[model samples]
Target: MNVVHILAALSEPTRLTAIHIIWDGGEHCVCELMERLNATQSRMSRHMGVLKAAGLVVDRRDAQWVRYRRNPDLPQSAACIVDAVIAATDVAGEVAA
Candidate 1:
């Protein structure tokens, strides 16, 4: 986990927006992300790709619905920082399995 890379990704405005949405909304599907960000699937996918690569998020597929949520098992200072922000503002209260 490159801490610099993770910070770089989250520091982007669009990705920060996505993170706030996901952090508040709990797990979200691709459609939810699109609607929330007012972004195309390709755009959202690109942002999600960055987050995933940063080890800051995780996705679980239930049927055809892929739910994206904050990653709890990532070993990085960046993950800790993101988790702190999320926890401080975590309206989700609890992360779903």
Candidate 2:
């Protein structure tokens, strides 16, 4: 995936938060994401679409729930970029709180 596309997908706060959650290394249900981010189902789904299009994440249908996680096959460079963004966001979050 193009770095520009990935960066663009993560450029928004809601999307970034979603990425951060997924980066923690487990599949999360869409409903769980909505609760964590305080977002509606539609809003979470929209952000997830952006991330999916960027090839940073993948989803699977688990019965009634859709689960999402970081794409394990992501290129090394892309993974590094994601890690960097997460790190930066964590530091920024610490400062804000």
Candidate 3:
């Protein structure tokens, strides 16, 4: 995966949170993400498109719903970066709260 592309895709807070939720919870439905992230369907889909384009996540149609999960074949370095970002953001969130 192109690090620059992946980094750019993850630069947004909503996108970053979506990744973290998928990373921590495994596959999740679009509706669930919408509720948890307080985003509209179209907004979540747009962000998910960015993640999919970055090779960081994948999705499949589950009847009427779309489920998303982290790409299992993600490069080690990219995975490390994602983990680091999640860790840093989680800490920052905790501190801010």
lDDT of 3: 0.87
Q: Give the per-residue lDDT digits (tens) of candidate 1, residues 15-90.
A: 7777877765378897888886678888888989999888888989878656798777777676577766655643
lDDT per residue as tens, model 2, 1-97: 7999988988888888888889989999999999988899988899999999999999999998789999999999999999998887763463245
TM-score of each: 0.72, 0.90, 0.89
lDDT agreement of model 1 with the native? 0.74
Error of 1 at 50 (Å): 0.5
> How does residue 49 of candidate 1 score in lDDT?
91
| Best-to-worst lDDT order | 2, 3, 1
TM-score (C-alpha) between model 3 and the true structure: 0.89
> Where does candidate 3 clash, by residue pair?
none
Instruction: Pick the lDDT winner.
Output: 2
Name the candidate, 1 or 3, with the larger TM-score value.
3
lDDT of candidate 3 at residue 31, scale 0 to 100: 98
Weakest 10 consecutive residues of candidate 2 by summed lDDT: 88-97
Query: What is candidate 3's lDDT per residue for 24-43, written digit by digit as tens?
Result: 74889999989988899999
lDDT of 3 at 78: 94
Q: lDDT per prediction?
A: 0.74, 0.88, 0.87
